[model samples]
Target: MPHLVILYTSQLDGETDMSALCRHLADTMLTLRDEAGKAVFPTGGVRVLAYPAAHGATTDGSGDHAFCYLNLRMARGRSADVHRRTGEALVAAARAHFAPLLAGRAIGLTLQVDEGAEVFDGKFGNLHPLFTPP
Candidate 1:
């Protein structure tokens, strides 16, 4: 399971298009491949979500300093190289997406990929079927 979650400051909500960013990230994830050339992240299992933080504080609390934090949670098994490439790709995508806005405002972007041990895992959905080849 791979879920990319984006948490952004509300200050950037007016200039940021969360929907577009979500699509951009999901599309980027689809392009990642493992050592075997197979998709690193399954298309059907991909999930991207963005949330605007209404109340939060960033470093050097100044005037409307915006921040976007991206966290990708994926299953553990991939090689370190694969994870590095994936993280770099995702971060690059985010930077490109916010380039124009970055020029006009002060924004901080942080990204990290986590593969934590889960005691219990459960998934129920029909979306996976839609991505399967007929």
Candidate 2:
């Protein structure tokens, strides 16, 4: 399972479409596949969400700056290379999404991939069946 959380300053709300950006991210992740060309991430397990920070300040408490932080949380089982590739793909997508805003102002963009605990408890629906063929 992979869950993406995007946190951006409210200042960029006018310039950036958070909802669209989230969708783009989700779509990008779905494209990732292993060496064999099999999908690495399940379609049903992909989740993208965005949050606008009402009050945030950059270094030196400068309100003029804007920031976007993307965090991808997933179960721990993939290799370092996989993680790196995923992060790169995500950052590239994000950069493209915010290219316009980047040209106009100082926007700090960062991506982080977090590996969850090895063992955890969870529940799910029959969504996986949709991805599986008979």
Candidate 3:
């Protein structure tokens, strides 16, 4: 399971479209594959969402800066290398997506990958079949 969440400051709202960025990120993740060429993340399990921060400040408490934080959460069991590669890919995607917004402003971009409990519970249905081959 992979869930991608993008958190950005409201300052960039008029400069960029967060919803479209989230879709681009999700599509990028879906294109990633393991060494064997198999999809690294399940197509049906990919989820991306964006949230605009109402109020935020920089390290010096300056409200003039903007920030974009990406959080990728997935089930545990993948190797460290896998995690690193995935993070790199996603961060690159984020950087490219926000390039225009970063041209003239001080924007802080960061990516975090969280490996959650492997024993978590969930129920998924028809979505799986859509991605499965006959």
Candidate 4:
């Protein structure tokens, strides 16, 4: 499973479309593949979530300063190269998505990929079954 969480300043709610960005990121994630050309992330297990921070400060808290941080968490079975590719792809997609805003406002965009030991994982949902081959 690949989960992408996007946190951005609330002011952006009036400037751009967060829902569109989420779909863009999710679509980008679906394009990832391993070196052997196998799909990297299962379509059913991919999720993109975005939250607007009601309060935030960037740099000196001056001059239309805004920020967006994207965190991608995945299972710990992928190779280092795959992890690297995932991060790079997400960042590239985000930058492209925010181009219009970045040109008009001082926005900081950051993306990171995290893969840590899962002490306990419990998943309950019917979404996965919808993507299974008949």
Q: Can you list the residue pairs that collide in candidate 4? A: none
Give the TM-scores of the predictions, in the order they appear: 0.95, 0.90, 0.88, 0.95
Q: Write the per-residue lDDT of candidate 2 for residues 49-84, one digit (tens) a residue.
A: 999997877878755888899999988778788889
Give lDDT for model 4: 0.90
Worst 10 residues of 4 by lDDT: 54-63
117 Cα displacement, candidate 1 (Å): 1.4
Q: Highest lDDT, which number?
A: 1
For residue 26, what is the lDDT in candidate 3?
Answer: 90
- Report the lDDT tens digits of candidate 3 across residue range 46-92: 99988898877777865488888889998887778788889998888
Whole-model lDDT for model 1 versus the true structure?
Answer: 0.91
The candidates, ranked best first by lDDT, are 1, 4, 2, 3
Each prediction's RMSD over C-alphas, in Å, is: 1.1, 1.6, 1.7, 1.0
Angstrom error at residue 46, model 4: 0.5
Q: lDDT of all the models against the reference?
A: 0.91, 0.88, 0.85, 0.90
How would you encode candidate 1's per-residue C-alpha lDDT over 1-134 as one tens digit per residue?
Answer: 89999999987778978899999999999999989999998889999999999889988876778899999999889999999999999999999999999899889999999998889999998988888899
For residue 103, give model 2's deviation from the true position in Å.
0.7
TM-score of 3: 0.88
lDDT score, candidate 2: 0.88
